[model samples]
Target: MTETFHEFVVQRSPALSRTAYLLTGDHQLAEDLVQTALARTYRHWRRIRDGDPEAYVRRVMYHQQVSWWRRRRLAERLEAEPTERAGGDHTDTTALRLTLTAALRHLTPRQRAVIVLRYYEDRTEAQVADLLGCSLGTVKRHAHDALRRLRAVAPDLLDATAERSTR
Candidate 1:
């Protein structure tokens, strides 16, 4: 059973890491979040394996993100940097990606989580709510708020800019 759990986790780690990165836009933090979630999942693998273990782990990640955001005094630092760029070439599309991620950081942690799960992971609102342990209404509200915020930050203006930059 333990070996099965280990294999599952190893197979799923990349997917979870990508989801976490989309949620937080911080690679190191995403790695940490996924690791923490995986640790908790490992502890309860026997119980959760029969259920949707991925959803269980995702819930742990969401809760962990919310708790970390609250404890880190994020609300007070609305203008703080998202996270340092992980060293790369200076392209215009890179600039847009940074802008997009910066806009995403302004959302509440839960809203960010919702967007990541919904858009990035292609999950429905009910699924997101289930994973986050929230009411469906709350997930809808968060997703709406996140979309509104993203629109306010960049809107559709940057898509053209990004496409031009890529060429």
Candidate 2:
């Protein structure tokens, strides 16, 4: 059973790592977060192996993210700014993706987690709340707040780029 669980975790690590990356913007942090979550999941493999083990792992990741956030609020900005691209050459979609990712960086970690779970992972509010060990109301609030922040940061980039014709 332990071997099977280990195999399952190894198989799912890449996809989970990608999801973690989308949640956290840093590659190394995402890797560490996923690894930590996997280790925690392994600790409870006997009880959780029957049901959705991946769900259990994800729940660990969500709680760990929230705990990390509580220890260090996301209000502080990073010292290193993202490098600006030469605007004349980059495609609008690429630019929009970068803009959206950057805007996400401004969100509180809980808000960012809600946005990632609700949008990127396509999980419902109830699922997010369950994973985060919070109420549905909290999940809704976080998602609403995150969306509002994102909209405020890049209104034109998010709303008006369908027919962007940059020359």
lDDT (Cα, tens digit) per residue for candidate 1, span 1-167: 88889888889889999888767777888898899999998888889998989888888999999999889843423444445546775686666667777778788899999988897789998988888889999999999988888888666535756577788
Per-residue CA lDDT of model 2 for 1-167, tens digit only, reads 77888799779988899778767777777887899998888888899888999988887887787677788744344433456756555776667767766787888889988998998899989988888889999999988898898888767665645556533
Q: For model 2, give the 10-residue run with minimal summed lDDT.
A: 73-82
Deviation (Å) of 26 in candidate 1:
1.5
Worst 10 residues of 1 by lDDT: 73-82
Off by over 4 Å in 2: 73-81, 84-93, 160-167
Q: Model 2, 164: alpha-carbon shift in Å?
A: 9.4
lDDT of each: 0.82, 0.80
lDDT for predicted candidate 2 compared with the true structure: 0.80
lDDT of 1 at 74: 38
The estimated TM-scores of all candidates read 0.80, 0.82
Question: Which candidate should be chosen as best, given TM-score against the real structure?
Answer: 2
> By how many angstroms RMSD does model 1 differ from the true structure?
3.5
Itemize residue pairs with steric clashes in candidate 2. Answer: none
